[model samples]
Target: MKLTVLVDNNTYIDQYYAGEPAVSYYIEIDDLKILFDTGYSHIFIKNAVSMGIDLNAVTHIVLSHGHNDHSRGLKYLREQYALPNARLVAHPLCFRPKSYENEYIGAPFSLEEINRLFCYQPAEAPVFLSENCIFLGQIPELYSFEKRKAIGTTIIDGAEREDLCLDDSALVCRTDQGLFIVTGCSHSGICSITDHARKVCQDQRITGIIGGFHLFDTDSKLEETIRFLSDLSPDMLYPCHCVSLKAKAQMLKYMDIEEVGVGLTIQL
Candidate 1:
């Protein structure tokens, strides 16, 4: 595997990366080097070192919720990347208290500021960061009609949240070209995060499904999310941060779609 798109929202308009948006994404299976979510600041560490990407070889940092353009790039990767031991597979209530109320608001910039340099492995459903990846937490809603709406549930400095408890997750690999979904904004509802990553990576074939499908999909959640991704008939389907454009034209009207922007690159 090998994925790039060091930041998105649509930019990388050819001609050598013109303009930018930075939403972060930089996976690389086998000797893994994940870093899915850390944009909107140092612009995903300066477009991931100009697309050569190697921020101290991050091991993991899969946070898909606690919005703020996805954890506000942990304040420019705690002041210009270095990792020292990067490991932050989220879902321990994804740092509680969120916002988006009157539109795009937030909370989650404490804990001495994201532990200064990330490392908080809290999960809920499936853990394992190796043996062929797997970091999906709290993605156990099991769709059945997907419904998770917590745009912003406040109450900090004393706990108590409303539960957008999104703690969103995704990162399932079984390679050799099979189940390899890796989201960060499907927000626990991209067919219930690919049917809970095929029942916690029991795997059954699903080659690609990259990041962010969050745009509050419609048209029947985009026709039951493409009939559950055409029965996991994956083979590549990378979306990007806060998917929109009318929920990706209702998921490209049910299949065939790929475009993550910002230095887009992918392999498997």
Candidate 2:
């Protein structure tokens, strides 16, 4: 499996690509071309074009969550390519209206609008995309240190309540070495996500992890995360997007956290 960073919060010094406070990854597993989490705008599309990735050929568009930073680009993708055949995969609640501090933070497109453009697959269970790739749905918050946190409020059946981001998910790829977990925001705790992936895939060895860890501070959570990751001992780490510099610095003290950017690519 191969993964390309189509859109991220940073770009390499010499790489000529747009950077945004978002996440989007173009993954090629087996014969399938999968797009994981469209970024904030057309920036993902523009970066894809720069990398010579054909968005029209994407077979699957998987959303990590309902957050705008991750799903907003779906609108631009539909307007630009209109990939009628690509499957749109996400949790059932991913389209529900969500607000953070009185500002919209949910997916820009409604369920009705999404159905018109692509084959909608609302998965509450793990869905296999290819022989090696699988989408981990509704990660369980099993770890005590990684406590469940609410990002904002979400409307369900016309009632507004705290959004613990039940719609958040991740993608896992089984390679010869181990599993490579791809995530966005990780509203579901990163360790919890990995643990769920291990349970679902029945594999404990993780080769690498890429995308937003949603770690902004070097607090207890970050320390616990470091401990967990240290125990897991993954071959590579590319923490970006919502991860802050201080958290990265803390991670670097214990593990080799690789650099991530818009034009970066990884093969496993």
Best by TM-score: 2
Which residue pairs show collisions in model 2? none
Q: Which stretches in model 2 have alpha-carbon errors above 4 Å?
A: none
Strongest candidate by lDDT: 2
**lDDT (Cα) of model 1:** 0.71
Q: What is the lDDT of residue 94 in candidate 2?
A: 97
Tens digit of per-residue lDDT, candidate 1, span 191-218: 7777677777777777788777776547
lDDT of 2: 0.92
In candidate 1, position 58 carries an lDDT of 86
TM-scores, one per candidate:
0.32, 0.98
